[model samples]
Target chain A: MPESTFLDSTELVLNMGPQHPSTHGVLRVILKLDGEKVLGTDCVIGYLHRGVEKIAENRTYAQFNPYVDRMDYVAAISNGLGYCLAIEKLLNVEAPPRAQAVRVILTELNRIASHLVWLGTHALDIGAITPVFYCFREREEALKIFENYCGARLTTHAFRIGGLQYETYDGFEKEVLAFCDMFLPKVDEYEELLTNNRIWAGRLKHVGVLNAEECKEYGVTGPVLRAAGVKWDLRKAQPYSGYQQYDFEIPTCENGDTYDRYTVRIEEMRQSARIMRQAVEKLAAGPIMAKVPKVIKPPVGEVYVSIEAPKGELGYYVVSDGTTQPYRVRVRPPSFVNLQALGRMVAGGLVADVVAIIGTLDIVLGEVDR
Target chain B: MADEQKPAGSPSPAPSGAGGVNPKAGPAAGAPKTAPPKPAAAAPPKPPAIMAATPWDSELARDLRDRFPDQIGETSTYLGQDFLIAKPDAIISILEYLKLEADFDYLVDITAVDWPKKPERFELVYILYSFAHNRRVRVKTSIADGYRPASAVGVHLTANWLEREVYDMFGIEFAGHPDLRRILLPEEWQGFPLRKEYSIVQQDERWVRENLGIESGQ
Candidate 1:
C-alpha cells in the first residue's frame, strides 16, 4: 500500500431526497460518501410536521381520536386503538367483550394491510416489481373490508373512546375470514416470487444487519427487533384490547439482516391471519359500546398505553387535567424512534444498500414526521 | 375542612356579585339547597387519583428509597401502572440503577410536559420497559426553566434523538447530548411548539417568510 493523499481519498456529499420516488415520502437524507461507500448520513425531516401533539392539547378527548389515525396512516386502526385505549384507561373503563373482539379483528386486519404496503414498497425499492403488484392485490382486499365496515379506506376512525364507533357490518366476520384464507396463500406466493430468488436475496442478504443489542440500544421494535431473535412482541409481552385471548406466534429470525427482516414480516402476515380467525370466532353477541359518559371528561390522571402496531410499539401518553380538553398528549411514534437508527445501519455500507436498509426499516413518513 | 372554608371565606361577596339576589331575598336564593351535597364531595379536592391510590411501600419503591434517600419523591400508580418521581440531579444515576440492577433496560420514550404556572416548569418523563421482569415503569423528574437534566444517551443510545425532540418541542435541553439540535423543527425556529403558551396554529413566522419568500397563511 502507498501513502494516501488528501485528493486521492476525499468524501463527497450527496443529497438523496426532499422529494424522490424511492424515499416513499419527503425524507431528505444527506449522505457523505467516499466514492460509493457511505461514510455518514443525516436525515432532514419535518417537512410534514403538523404539530399533532399541540393539536391534541386543544381538542377534547373524543374529538382527538381522528387525528391519531392520520399519524400512522397505513395502520390507521392500530393508531385508533392505542388512542382510544389510552383515553379509556384514563377514564377507568373497559370496552365490552364484543367491542374488544371487534377491535382485535380490525387491528389485526390493519396490521396485515400495513405489512402488505411495506412488502410492496420494500420489494419495489429493491427493483422487484412483480411482488409490489401481487402484494397490493392482497392489500386491496383488506382495505375493502375496512371501507365496508367504517366507510373510510385509509384514515378510518374505526374505534371511539371505550368502544367501537360502528357495529360490525353485515357479513363482516365472513369477509374477514374469506380475506384471511385468501391472504395466507398469497403470502406463500410472494415467497415463491422473491424469497429465494438469486437477485432478490443477493441485494438484501447480509445488508444492514442490526443485532439484538443494537436494536435494544436504539429502541427499535416490531419486525426489526424480532428479526434480531429478540422474540419481544408487545402483544404477547403486554396484552391489551383483549389481545390476551388471541393465539398467535411471534416470528423471529437470527441474522437480523435485511433479508431476515423480510422473512420475519412474511411469517408475521401468516400469524396475523391466524389471530384474525381466532378473534372472529370469539366475537360474541353483546353490546358493542360501553357505559361511557356523554360528556367524556376523565378524572385528573395520566396513563401511558402502548400497542403492538405494524411498525412497532405505538404509545400514547395522556395527561388529563380534570377538564373537557386534555392538558397534554404525547405520542411515542415507533417510526420516529426507529428512524434514529438509520445512520447506524447505513453507515459503512454501499450507497445502493441505503435504499434497501430504509426499505427494510418499513418507516412511514406520516408517523416519523408527525 | 375544604367545604367549611368555602362558606367562610368568599360567600360574603360571592352571592351579591353572582346575580341580582339581595339580602332581603335570601330565602328565595337559598331555597334551592334542598338536596345536600354528598359526603364524598365534601372532601378536599383529590390529587389525580394516582397520588391517592399508590402505596409508597411497594417492594420496588422500598428498594429505590433505600438506595437513594430523599431522591425518590413519589412512587405512584395509576390504572395498575407504576411511576416514580425522582430528583432532577439523581435522574441519570437512578436510570442507570434501574437498567443495571432492576432490569429496566429498554428506554421506550423520553418526553416532557410543560407546566407554565408550576415553579418546576418542565416535567421530564422517561418511560422504560424491562423484558426480563415483563414490566413497564416511568421515571420522571421536574426541572426549572433553564436547568438542563443529564442526558440518558450514555445509558441508552435511543435518547439521542428523543432528547433532541424534547428540546425542540419543549425547549428543555439535556446536558451532554452529542447532537442537541432541533430534531422535529428547523434549526432557526423561534419558540418551542409544545410549550403551554404555544398554540397549535402559531408558527415561526419569520422562518416561513424568509424560507418561502411569502407571507404565512396563518
Candidate 2:
C-alpha cells in the first residue's frame, strides 16, 4: 500500500456479441470503449472455424468443391469457381469454351447477388431499411436463376473438376436476360436512394479513408482496392474462365473512403451485369467437360490459381502428389485478408462509423471464420 | 558411312561419286564454278535455349539474384520461369532485399508443402510480386526438423497471417513471427494435420465420433 493517498481508476470493456445481430455471424469483438469511442478493439473469431483447410487435405479434389461453397455462402458460386480453376490448372485440363462461358455467367450473377446483400445490409446497418427489401427483391430473382441451373439456390456448387457438372438449363439465357433488364433499373433505384443523398454522403464520405498505396501494401483487392483508385482487377489483369472475352470496365474512385467503396461496388454491380450479358451472348454449342480421366490424379506439383471473386481475389493453392486427395489445399480467402485492415480502418473512428466501415467492407463472416 | 559423307549445308546428298554434287540443285547453282562455293548460302541460326529467357522473364528474381549474389543460391528455371531455392537462413535477408532494394511491395502468399520422403521435411514457398516490374517470383527454402526459416513479417505485413497459417497447417515454425499462434486451428489441436505422416483416420474418427455422434470403426 502507498503511504499517501491514492486515487482509483477503472476502464470499461464491452463484449459485443458472438450472438448479436450486427456481429454478422458468431463474431465476438472485444471493444474497449469510452462512451461510444473505441479505445481499442480486438476481434475474437473461431467460434465458426471448422478447419476447412484440414478437411480439404483429407478429402479428394472433387469432394472438396461443396465444402468451399460453405466458406463464403453469400457468394458460393465464386468460391466454387476458384477451387475448380485451381484444380483444373493442377490437373492440366482446360474447361471447354461453353463451360467457361457458363462459369463466367454464373459467377458474375453471383457477384451481383453478393453485392446486393452487401448494399442491402450496409444500408440497413446505417439506418436505411427500405433498400434491404429492394435488394432482396432482386436477390430472389438471382437465386431463382441459380436454382434453375443447379437445383440449389444459395450454395449451387455448380462447378466441377474439369468443367461444369452439367450444362446450363434449357432456358437459362432467357432468365438471365430478364434478370439483367430488371437488375440495371434496380441498381439505379439503389443509387437514387443512397448515392447522392446528403445524409448518406455525410455519413460515408472521407470516413475510414484507406489510401491506394496502403490498400496494395495490405493486399486489399476487389472493390476495396478499386475504391482506393487502384485499377487492379483480377478479371482484367489476370483473367480466368473466359473473363477476358467478356466486355466490362473496372470502376475506381479517387477518394479511398467508405463512400468510395460504396460507389465502386455499385458501379461493379452494373459491370458484372455487363459481363453476364456478354457471356450469355457468347454461349455456343460445345462439350462442357474436357476429356479428363476418371481418376483425377494430377501430377506431383503445386499451382496457385486465383479468380476475381465477388469479394476480391479468391485464390486456391493446391499441391498434389499424384494423389486423388491434395497434399495441401490453401484458400487465399479475400474476406479474411480484407478483414485484417479492419483494426486500421476503425482505429480512431466513432463506434457508429466502425459499423459503417465494417458494412462498407462487405465481409461475409463465413469466409472470415473459415 | 554414306550419311556421314554429305557436306555440312547440302540440301540433299548426291548418290556417291557423282562428281560430289547434289542432284536437286536449282538452275542458278547448276553452272556454278568452284568460286569457293559462295559460303554455302549462310545457314539459318538455331533457336536459343528456352531457359535463357527464364531469368529475363522475371526481372524481380533476376535483380534479387544479382543484388545479393552471395545470399541468393542457384536460380532454377522450370517451364521457362525462374525460382530461387535459397538457404533457409538467407530467406529473411532476401525478403528484406526484395522489399527495400527491389520494391517487390507485395507478399502475395506464404505457403508450405510437405515432402516427407526428402531429407528436408518441408518446402516453405514465399511468392513475392513487384507491381512496378509486373513480374512474380517464387522463393523457396527447405525446412528440416530442428531448423526454422526466418520470418518475413518485418518486410511484409501480409505475411503475419500467412505465416501463422503455414505454422498452423505444416508445423514449420517461422522463427521470429510475432504471434505464432495457430490461426485456422484451435490452440489445443493435437497435430499438424497436413503432414503426410500424420494419421488422418485417427483424426477423422475422433471428429466424427465426438462431433457428429458417428461411432468409430464404422
By lDDT, the best candidate is: 1
lDDT of 1 by residue, A225-317 (tens): 999999999899989888888888999999999999999999999999999999999999997777665445678878999999999999999
> Model 2: iRMSD?
20.0
CAPRI rating of model 1? incorrect
- Tens digits of per-residue lDDT, candidate 2, A287-336, equal 88775554455666667777888888888878776655677887888888
Q: Residues B88-132, candidate 1, lDDT per residue (tens digit)?
A: 999999999999999888999999999898999999999999989
Candidate 2 chain A lowest-lDDT run of ten: A1-10
Instruction: Provide the overall lDDT of each model, using Cα atoms, as 2-decimal numbers.
Output: 0.85, 0.77
- Backbone clashes counted, model 2: 0
Q: Which residues of candidate 1, in runs, are more than 4 Å off?
A: A1-7, B1-51
